[model samples]
Target chain A: MNNADHPTQSPGNVAGIRRQVVLPLGKSIEIAYNSIRVRFFRSLITTLSLVLAVSFLSFVNVSTDVANGLLATGQPELRQALVRAGYDLAPEDRRADSSSKQRWIVLLSLLVCAVGIVNAQLMAVTERFREIGTMKCLGALDRFVMRLFLLEAGMQGLVGAAAGALGGALFALLNGFILFGGQAVRLVPANELLLSLLWATAAGCLLSLIGVAYPAWVAARMQPVEAMRVEQ
Target chain B: MTTNKNIVRVTNVTKTFQLGKIAVHALKGVELEIPTGQYVSIMGPSGSGKSTLFNMIGGLDKPTTGKVYIDEVDVSQLDAYELAWLRCRKIGYIFQTFNIIQVMTALENVTLPMTFAGMRNDEAIEKAMGLLDLVGLGDRFQHKPFELSGGQQQRVAIARALANDPAIILADEPTGNLDLKTGEEIINLLQNLSHERDVTVISATHDIKMLNVSDLVVWIRDGRIDKIESRDELTISVGRIDARNA
Candidate 1:
């Protein structure tokens, strides 16, 4: 009549997931972990697709900008206009002057990170309807529900932000070295690193709130009867 | 006849839900009084407004018409924050599915309401453990809902309902999902809570076995009270076992 009815109670019964693997919040952490893991995969697909799209745009934009800058550098009339633009056929100095291109790429990455985080957070919220409803039935107020989900997003955001910022900085640093070969190069852009980390956290919070709004609203509006009616 | 001693008073309460263009009347002109320390069961077929009544009494929903009073306070008039406070301090709920948080231990589930009541974490955990022990889940304190059987889960839920020392425990089909033997165990637990602890227990269920544990049974048909029967009198009218089947 009691837990003796549980099939999993018997030892040697497949030795499934042990009850002892307790996370800090245990089940909530598992739920959040699973949800974010799934989101991480989905974000991978989204990021890859976005990279392709942005790469094409970047090639076109950079080429066009460089051509325009050089053309503008030319006087109204000049035979050997290549030298007139001071866009030396030499690749070294030209690359150094490519700060404008660096700015454009960084801006694009920022846009991509924003969209990715927001998309991931929104998807996570949509999938947790029953969880949110359960919280509400347990007497969670609207703001309390908001805070819990926001915490979930915050956790994921922290991970994603840290990873993304570190990844961007490391890549930029490596590329700076590669571009300069054995020569001196500013591989550590302290300002860019700081800016990206800040942006990462902000993006995380923003996306999480955006993602959580729909689910939070759904949770707040649930009637107790309706909430309890949800099956596993 | 409303009395000051009534813990819950519903006066001509009505509830309506608008689904797109159609309006659904969940409860119609329902009036009732439940004095303190009464174990009452509400029974009706689907759409009979049984759960609707429980919802209104628990302050989970607002009545479209009339009013709901808890301890003479018009809970229907309270704002969302006020209703939440009342729910935390005065009401406990048990659901058919057990509705225990899946990720939380039995003890944690029991202490959830206290957490909302703003108790310190350690205090809530200690009290929750005490409640779990009281409900016979002492050995299963760290067990999750999925780890417990149906009856044990319901016990955890009962412990949870008693968590805040609430005046009233509102349960919707607390035993509907359990096997007969398990259901009986759950009923016994609830009955003990009502009789021994003097907690006002209001349950909405179709389970005849559950009615055997109730002090009073309120039968509803078509959103109105069809009959009210006292267990002792009903037992006298027909033998105890037969009365339940009847």
Candidate 2:
């Protein structure tokens, strides 16, 4: 009888919520959206911080690429004059990318972006400790909890990054025109600038995901009793 | 009691917590069996390990040694997937703080567990509405947790607990946050559900009034079962339910 039961031993025939399937991804996304909507002001602050950080980083990247593109147009006198004025021009052969100094600025901006994301995600995880516990008690799997947090972070990051990237690229274009006049538009390096914007937006999403990974793991692995024991 | 009739079995269970350099034994080879459909209450002073024992039975925590069996399946040996399966279908939890999803409406909160159970959306909503009506919150379906009174929030919680029609209901201090009058009402409701639905109700509580409705009361002292008494033996034990001892 024991072996006979083994073949048919999914929890019960009445309910289909066993190991065969998990809560739908769409439902988790809906829950994530609703949670963000419910905490409108908090979500706003998190998105705003992402926006500012991504904008700064993207602006740096775009302007650097524009500067490099204009410097490589084979104008030696112009380049020397620019170099004399404290501009660190790259070698002619390597005038294909942002300067090393500007790359460091990009890295710095990314660090600041990561710090902003970490703060927002950490706050979200702490606030949802009890809720996470309750969800676990209600049969939400570890993957489900992780997915819910990632979904929220991804949604916020995507929106903020897209807006920030576009805003930064446009502003960078305007700045380039002001500094180098018609020469700037003539050597716009539109492809490189667009690539930087894309990279910045992707970085925003990736960093948001990475920022939430630790907290999500912690939440998913928490003993429900320990989580529910917390009063606040 | 025969193992066949017992729905829950705790055998030689020992749980140790590491607190700094000290090892605190929460349960020391504790053995217990709860028959199907019994309304059991676990009572003890704080730090006496009753809550830890409750956690073991509820599958919220695994014992460091020995095993827990729910419906003949060894729960301590189950993986997370199987644990979630058991929690989703076999047992329901009602927290003292009424841990309903705070952002959703009362109706939405009750429907959540059903969704985890893979019920259809409309069907889940219909059942959830019925449950709310049963808990006397039918008219307040749209109210969020903050919008409801304490008693109302707890009623919603109870409704949520019953959403999946779990065979076992675990209430951890269900009436702890309510006033005496409301507390009594919640207790009566639980008692009625226990008899009416034939579901096993295990409540870890300090409310002395629970004695009136319990089928069995298990008292824990330190890390061991001090006594186990049926409803018939409760009259003799009622005098022992002191504030410090409970």
Candidate 3:
């Protein structure tokens, strides 16, 4: 509160004050992390939904591959069942059909998970009206606000994707081992398994970024006065 | 530091809002000049556009047809990014709700603006501590907003508003949520900041007590300035009225 300590006007300081850099990336990410921590249950629910969807997708992919491989063994009972169902198809044809169907199912599941993410993020944005306003009043650039939300969504996506992939892989391994004993190891292509997990992770991250884009934009464009006037 | 030059100038500023196809005039060609290091209180009833005018001066909103100048620089001419820099470096805002980010500690809340201004983490923390101490909240640095009382929370908000060392502090009904005694303390704190630091402090308030401490009191009605008088003038007018009644 000392008068001398606080200068009323700094000589020739007008133009110098205008050259503000965007907020540091590290600080924005830290704020996003704190926000995620504050709303732990909400974020967890959104992430868990993502995990389930992703895991189901991976499971479809792995299970179809394993199923196709098992059919290739020329097991009489399985072949007879196929015959009873009037397929009477070769193992190669069945594998191709299953691969196409798995692709469709994975695509469908991702769509559903994307919708869930959008809903969750919208709700988050609505709840944080005052918080966003406060940030803006504190001189946060719009891009900084947008980046914080995108970073939060990215973090959730990464966690959910990793967990989902691992869960799906474990399920496939267990199901194969229970059914086909020593042959299960050979049927579940270890290399393909690694690639699918990576794909799932990438897909999850992309989906999250897309889902949060609208809400982040809305938050970034909010007028500070109007936002603060919103009833909490 | 005290100067005759006006730190803020509002020139026939008028603001209109389109609310559901109906035009509502919030400010009606209001003109005023706030000199450097002055404590000015804008007093009006609800819906008198005090808050709207405060927002214009603070650069939170633009006037519909008039200009707002801070240090003689026209605010309306600046782009969004420039306005943000102006808000960051030249003006601080305190709201009635004491809008501290609830998730952060008091110290963190105070440091947020500095952080946005690109201050390094260590320097920001050090300055934030000083601000907190200045507002008498040094002991509550680590406390969250929910853990503090209303007055304490408002003190934290005040510290936060001062974070960037802005020359102008715009407070919109800062004591609207506080009790009488706490409200007085906050008013005293603001007055002291104005007097000691040579910062221009402008507040919009319904509290009559604020008029006693303000160097100038502006009365508004229906989005227009009804009168502007110094505290001494107001006191003299009141004395004349009291003598006539007696």
Candidate 4:
């Protein structure tokens, strides 16, 4: 008998309707969104860390340009040292110094942000032990689980980066106006602001993905039995 | 009670866990077969390796030695991806703790397996709703796991187990967390699914009451099969004893 005509056939059966199995991106996103919603405070805290880091990075970048400009007129030796260290001494070069010090600051801030992302994701994986086990038992491939986590991290990064960019831009604008008056408008160039936003967002997204890699691998490799044994 | 239609076959399956330097043998060369569409119960005391055997049959774990054949496919030989496909499409699992994702609603929980199987969301939801209705939880679909009663949560779990129309259902202490009456209802539901849907229902449980509905009760002790008894044989044996007493 056909499944539809069979007495035992459940409403759940989409018998005879077959489709090639593709990655369920939409469902994965929805599940990730639901998870974020459920752990709203924890997710918020993690995202906030990214926000603060990105904002700090952007603000420092802008303030350095302003400081370099001031130093250019005051200390010839300092300006020469900064120029040797790769600062643009030319007044038109608003991009300022790509000095080793600035690079160090950027690297340190990113490192801190990356560590925060890893810690948050690791805790999240630990908290969802049973949930992960249940998903594995229900036929979720390891890659599927990994994708879900990566997507979650990406979403957090995207939102956090956007917010941080806005905050940094505003901070730089206000601080410059207070410090340099009317010249502050010209100090924060439109192109530079846009570029900073783009770079910060890209970096945030990349950092988040990198941070989740180890945790996602650990979660994916967990045996269903071992994972389920964890206290809910 | 061997049959040509054996759907699950196990041959000398042994599992060992290396706990630091000590090796703990969970299953010691266990061997068994379960025929198609049968309700088989693995009954044993705690720590007797019944759960380990169940996990083996469900493809959740690999045996240290020997093999497990589900639908004639050597589960031990299958890679992770193949094993995941087998689990997603051919086998369903119910756990003692009712391992429904707490963050999801009953409908969402039920839809998860299908989602992993690459079914579209709308189609999965429709099927999930149907499965919930079949399990008498249509009204509880919107409720989260914590919001539902123990019995209702288990019903959602059962619906989820049936989500992919799997041929084999592996339940590890399916009713362990429920009260007697609720446990009985769950057992009745499983029994009906086995009989009517022709799905093989294999459970590892300590509850003796499960034997009443099981076709074959396999007794296990110390990681070994002590005996295998069919329900009809049990009934006949009971009848003879009652007659002698009379």
Return the top candidate by TM-score: 3
- What is the descending TM-score order? 3, 2, 4, 1
* lDDT tens digits, residue span A77-156, model 3: 75554445343366455442345656787788889888989898989888888888888888877888899999999999
Q: Encode model 4's per-residue lDDT on A151-194: one tens digit a residue.
A: 88889889888888778767866776675565545544556667
**Clashing residue pairs found in predicted model 3:** none
- In candidate 2, which residue pairs clash? B44-B246
Model 1 chain A: ten consecutive residues of lowest lDDT: A14-23
For residues A1-232, what per-residue lDDT tens digits would candidate 1 score against the true structure?
A: 2221122323442122122111234434554554455457654543442333233333333332333333343333321343443333443323223346655775676566556655654554555555555566666666665555555665655555455545544454444344333221232234534554565445544544554456545555655445556464
Ranking by lDDT: 2, 3, 4, 1
Provide the overall lDDT of each model, using Cα atoms, as 2-decimal numbers: 0.64, 0.82, 0.81, 0.80
Query: Model 2, residue A99: displacement in angstroms?
Result: 1.8
What TM-score does each of the candidates earn?
0.74, 0.87, 0.89, 0.85
Better of 3 and 4 by TM-score: 3
Off by over 4 Å in 3: A1-21, A68-89, A92-99, A185-187, A230-232, B236-246
Distance from true location, Cα of A115 in model 4, Å: 1.3
- Residues B1-246 of candidate 4 have per-residue lDDT tens digits of 234488899999899999999999989999899999999999888788887888889888889999998887788666566666677778888888898899899999998888877777899999999999999998889998899999999899999999988889998888888999999999999999888888999999877668889999898899999889999877764467568979
- Give candidate 1's error at residue B103 in angstroms: 2.2
* Pairs with steric clashes in candidate 1: none
